[model samples]
Target: MGKWNAKGLELAQKLEGVTDEKAIKKLATETMQEIIDACPGEGSIKRPRAALRKAIESVYPSLNAEDNYPQGYYRTSEGKGKGERYEHLALWYLTTNIDRWSVEGDEGRQQYWGNLPTLEKTEPKPQQTKQQKPKQKETVMSQLNLDLDTETQQALDFALKQSGLEEKEFISRAIAYYAKSIANRHEVDFATIPTEKLLNDSSLAKLPGRAEELTRRAVRAISIYNDDIAPENSERWAITQSAIARLTGGRAKSIQKALEDYQGMIADHHAKYELNNYSNRKSGGRTIEDTINIAEL
Candidate 1:
């Protein structure tokens, strides 16, 4: 009962109402075979076997009593000698140990058998020194106040109710996600753009707004998709098609189609750009400029 591993617990369960010695021995044999099969390696076999042996010896102490035969006599003998006799002894040990543990008082049981035969060998956890202890993370707290229009407030409420998130959590997450997306987008843009044009590009000013719009569209698409397939619950998007249409200014089907089209475009673009040294030019193909120069020549 005290954190017995699967095999040990199983043997114990099978032993219940099994008063016959033959049945117990058979169960012991089967359990030993299973343990051996589970752990075949020499290094891995010792602890489980020892635990099982201890269990059996505890229940039937007579088995552990000194044999009249000489120590090396059984090893040299052919049939049903020491190795064969104790081949399945581990299981009997486990069964007997389980029985003994069951009868003991609570304190005695805890003291003796509480941590026995988890089946896997467990090493003692090393004590953590003052220097080894993990340093606590310092959190900087900030406050924000937002004034919303009635329509915006209603939309925020609807989103919060549908998403099953607290207003503070949702707002914090939204801000964090938006900030991360903007930062990533800016980094990509900086890397890709020519240095001279980078400062002069008027379109750079609109990147944040474009990113926000794309982010909103993505979030809306995900929300619609979740609602369409999700199980019926308070958390599920339970809004009617007409309500969805009104909110999104398009039918659910149209929104889904648009999302699919957008995803396909993204996939196509990635596939197109992912290849190394990709170009429209064929091997040994002449450029239009080269043909024009030849004609001039």
Candidate 2:
């Protein structure tokens, strides 16, 4: 059996007679929290959750299918508030399977439960030879030559003077900010439209006339931007502005206006559809639902 399966069996034996659902959930939550606290890094909870779930599944095979479990047994919602109900179910199964797990051997039990073995206990490093020379220290910093345009050079000089920071420090901060901005750029290539379409469409330069079309494109970009980008990053708004500018061939001011319009439109759309069931009723001889499909957007 796999490590988690064996661990699950062992856990089952230990949790024998613990039939209370609340008790089982508390034990599982505490176990996971302990693992997360011990590791103290990214994926600490995620890795242990996955392992524990696998172990639980080994004991209760019915959990693998939605039909075998109650409604909302896996997730509680469709959006950000969705809860992991399966984790609790998995823990309950482990407690109930004590008889089945008791048959497994005690081998490998020390590796997972109780105190995790230290690195030194698991594997020892090789000793250095007497004749071997110690390695030389490596350089930690790298030097780069930059060819800045007149405008950029002046900006950098002004920033350095205003901030009272060293030239290297100012440049380093600028580079870091620029790198993060570039990273926040739209993950999807202009909402899956070909680059050539936006770049080659010279007619997009004519603004105000094609403002509606521009707003539609901005809506799509905003939808994708919100889904992919984190709200905490201030650069996210700038990145979305840049995307709209590229898509519509418009200036910063024009793109900003388009974004404002897109936001208002989205709010109006949601209010109409949700409050009035506007999609089901007719308006101006046609159903508003037929006219506007937010899902398509």
Candidate 3:
């Protein structure tokens, strides 16, 4: 209703699932408190009792009763609509926005559940039958704004027409081609996180999957940063970092450094490796997994 509450909702988007009711509530309370701290004029100091939960519920409204009351968690809910919707929302959101934090209960093997479309958790995956169905690839949607000169646009349109493919498909192929053939020569501009420290020396299981997940997030952020800027001036990326940042509302210094480093990588690549077309002609945009893997590369 007020500034603090509105900010509270924005903060709630950052919440991943915690283990139990107590943890969730504590997280919710902390989130609300953060909003209150940030929005001094919102007068959230007098925010109602359980106001934090109410604010949090605004984000995950299905949260109802805790599976374990008092000492336990606010993690589980019993009601049909609220709880079910929460599960669906969480699964869809986490899988698509893999960069987002995940729930406590949904870690470990449960993380694999993200691969499925439905919220329904299957029983422990039965022993692999000899006759295994091909896994279906999940889908993700991204939107972009791009600009091109009339001639380039005409060329793009002509190519798409000749290929009989939609804009997204053509774009996907072009991006894949450029990355593999053109962009793979040099070191990336950003550093990736190391999860080796997370690995247990004694446990054969080694490190938890979260390490890989964190790496994926870092990779995604860099990929997104590169993709989101100056589509029209792509050819001049080496010399146009300032323009790119101005257009994209990003820091010019950062853009300059990334573009220069990437260009250096390309220049260096020319010395050692021949360009690789890596041809595997497909009809359209790849599966979501393929897209993510390409970005990682």
Say which candidate scores most in TM-score.
Answer: 2
Model 1 steric clash total: 3
Q: Which candidate is the best by lDDT?
A: 2
Instruction: Please tell me which model should have the higher TM-score, number 1 or number 2.
Output: 2
Off by over 4 Å in 3: 1-4, 7-60, 63-109, 112-297
Tens digits of per-residue lDDT for model 3 on 1-297? 765566555546655544354344344433432332233232334453244445555655553343323222223333465452233222222111122222344353255445443323223333452122122101212234455678986786566546544345557777876775444444332224333422222221222333234333333433443346324322112212222222222222333344543555544432333321111111362212332222233
lDDT of 1 by residue, 1-297 (tens): 322244565565566566454455556644543443355343565677666655544443332324553221111111365432322222322331223312223254354445542222234335542223223101211234356678986786566546544345556777886785576466343435442343235445344333223323433443443345434322222122212222323323343333443555444433543411122122463222222111111
Q: Which residue pairs in model 2 clash with each other?
A: none
How would the candidate models be sorted by TM-score, starting from the highest?
Answer: 2, 1, 3
Q: What is the lDDT of residue 147 in candidate 3?
A: 57
RMSD of each predicted structure? 28.4, 20.6, 24.5
Candidate 1 lDDT score at position 268? 48
How well does candidate 2 match the true structure in TM-score terms? 0.23
lDDT of candidate model 2 versus the reference: 0.41
Clashes of each: 3, 0, 10
Candidate 3: lDDT of 38? 38
Stretches > 4 Å off in candidate 1: 1-6, 16-21, 63-297
lDDT of 1 at 228: 55
Error of 1 at 54 (Å): 1.7
TM-score of each model, paired residue for residue: 0.20, 0.23, 0.20
Ranking of models by lDDT:
2, 1, 3
